[model samples]
Target chain A: MHIIIVGCGRVGAQLAQILSSEGHNVVIVDKNQESFKRLGADFNGITITGVGFDPDILKRAGIERADALAAVTNGDNSNIMVSQIAKRIYNVPRVLTRIYDPLRADIYKKFGLNTIGTTTLVAHIFRSALLKESAKHEFTIGNDIGLVEYRVEEEETAAKESGGGKK
Target chain B: MYVLIVGGGKVGYSLARRLADEGFDASLVEKEERMAKRIAEDLEQVLVIAGDGCDPGRLEDAGIARAQVVAAVTGDDEDNLIICQLARDTFGVPRVIARVNNPSNEITFKKLGIDTVSSTTIISKLIEEEATIGDIFTLLALKRGKLSIVELIIGPKAPAADKMIKELRLPADSILATIVRESHIIFAKGETVLKPGDSIIALATTDSEMALREALLGKE
Candidate 1:
């Protein structure tokens, strides 16, 4: 599949490498030519130095035939704008964007764009690993619905033993 | 298979409802009579019983011995722990999952041989971190924040495409762990050439998500 990645930052670069290694056509767009230097001498994909949201830049990145688009730039607005263009104008089958603010996640979701919040995902990791004794408040299964996993600990015992069962 | 969930709170109700929707044999035991009645009214197939989840008698009454997996998701951490222990030790349920409200209590639960989830703490932290850090995929956290698993999908315009995995001078702190293509998962190797549509899973420090992404997808 042909994939276009806007933003040459950490997420975009890594995503490009992953897809490239998997044997798919990949193109990366960025504003700075120096950013491509980070990919090193052996890197093997097309790198376009231009604003990701610019239509001309996208066309140069082969957005017309792209199957998917990922907007993971540092700025949320830029990511959203690029993703919208990719989905609406370019007609990419799949479009994903990195949303820094969790509050805006719902707004993006309503537009049918897949959003991933870096902070929320990370915090969940830390909390799960660090806080294991407190009463679990919520658990989710799959992306939509599946088996939600949770941990049972001491506070739960006190609630059951002292709180008394169903009065 | 009869799935017994101990707790009638949001998690329990949601689980019961979802399982029921999937055509599973699900039941809930809520110690509070009112909560039990409410859950019973809300669910069509779930059998809601008001009883102490930790009590062996209550579990037996809920047919714990015949349950495929006993989930303890009561609001209280202690109650969940006891229910899980009893389910494993006394009732002999094959699978038991407990909810941990406090993130700090995870180790104790693990030592007790029960799976635990600090969903609230973790989810809140996730939201907080996303608000602060701005970029990078957290992937899966491990060792209480000491490690993480992140993924970055190669983009069409990236510089690393068409090059062998060994050719790219990846940072020392990061390692390309797996390559996903067309839903097929492959281990990363030196001879492997990165292509478009490939998803790369890597293990690195929390701060490295952005760097990894830049390395794999950033443009010139």
Candidate 2:
């Protein structure tokens, strides 16, 4: 599959590495040439240095034939614009964007755009960890279906066994 | 009409001031609190709100629901695009205008039915018009910049000076619309004779702009 990923940050680089190693044609774009270093030497994917939302740059990255496009730029607005251009303009099959603002992510979802907001997701994960709950809120499928991950550590099992008598 | 402007940069600030002075209800949203306060103090009529315009909540605070027009003139094209989308799609504003910092993004904005103003395109056109072809000025660009209506003043030594319109070798796509001699407007005809200092208005495609300029103003 031909994949185009905008932004070469940690997540972007990791995704590019995994996809590239899985034998997919990957092209990564970033505004700074230095960001490409995050992909390291083992990565075998094309790197483009230009604004992610610029049509010329995206075309240069072969967006016309891309099966999937991921917009992971730090700027939520940039990611949203790139995702829209890829999905609405180029009609890429799969267009995903990362938006830091939870409000913006929800708004774009209402517009029928695929967006992932890490701010809320990470906060949920941290909150669940801090509360030491076995059921960790991973994500929700929709309004009602919440997918929770259950963790059963040895220490948790021991604590439960010891507190069983007290209860 | 109520106008909501996002971004506190020079364009947004001055636009709000002008709109307020013109008796239109205008409010500006600036992300920087200090700049917003400064602009609020400077402009008594316009309302200034300090918050990121890309955030819908901030736009709501600026009263986007009842805004007749929304203008996003931020330096960042992405932010402007988002703001315009929010204004148009979410709030259903009658008109949404955005500043395209990168000229390449103008098509994207236009495709989404958002009006765009590119300072880069405008400034470059002005510089090129002033530096090389001082007499020929672009009155308006139409058809997505494919066609332009231009005005050119006939110089004393211009090739077309003292010659009839039919005699000049105008570009194939060029059409002379009118000739203004002094303050009187005359509809251009094949038999209309050109005179020095006459301002000629013509419609031509972007590709024919240089040829039309040369035909009227002579090569510089």
- Give the candidate number with the greatest DockQ: 2
Tens-place lDDT digits, model 2, residues A1-167:
99999999999999999999999999999999999999999999999999999999999999999999999988999999999999999999888888889988888877877777778877866765677777544554222334455556834331221111111
Superposed by TM-score, candidate 1 places the C-alpha of residue B200 at a distance from the truth, in angstroms, of 4.7
| Interface RMS deviation of candidate 2 | 0.7
Would you list the C-alpha lDDT of every candidate in the order shown? 0.75, 0.88
Chain A TM-score across all models, in listed order: 0.79, 0.85
Candidate 2 per-residue C-alpha lDDT over B89-197 given as tens digits, one digit per residue, 9 for 90 to 100: 9889999999988898989988777899998998997787688766778899999779999998998999999999999999999999999999999999999999999
TM-score of each: 0.45, 0.83
Pairs with steric clashes in candidate 2: none
Per-residue lDDT, model 1, residue A76, is: 69
What's the TM for model 2? 0.83
Q: Which candidate number maximizes TM-score? A: 2
lDDT of 1 by residue, B1-220 (tens): 7899999889999999999999989989999999899889889799988987766677888888899899999886656765786688666788999998766546546654689878977788889767754434567888767678877777777777888988786767788999999998899999998998788888987666556666777732
Q: How many backbone overlaps does candidate 2 show?
A: 0
Cα displacement (Å) at residue A93, model 2: 1.6
Q: Candidate 1 chain B: minimum summed lDDT over ten consecutive residues — where?
A: B129-138
DockQ for candidate 2, C-alpha atoms: 0.68
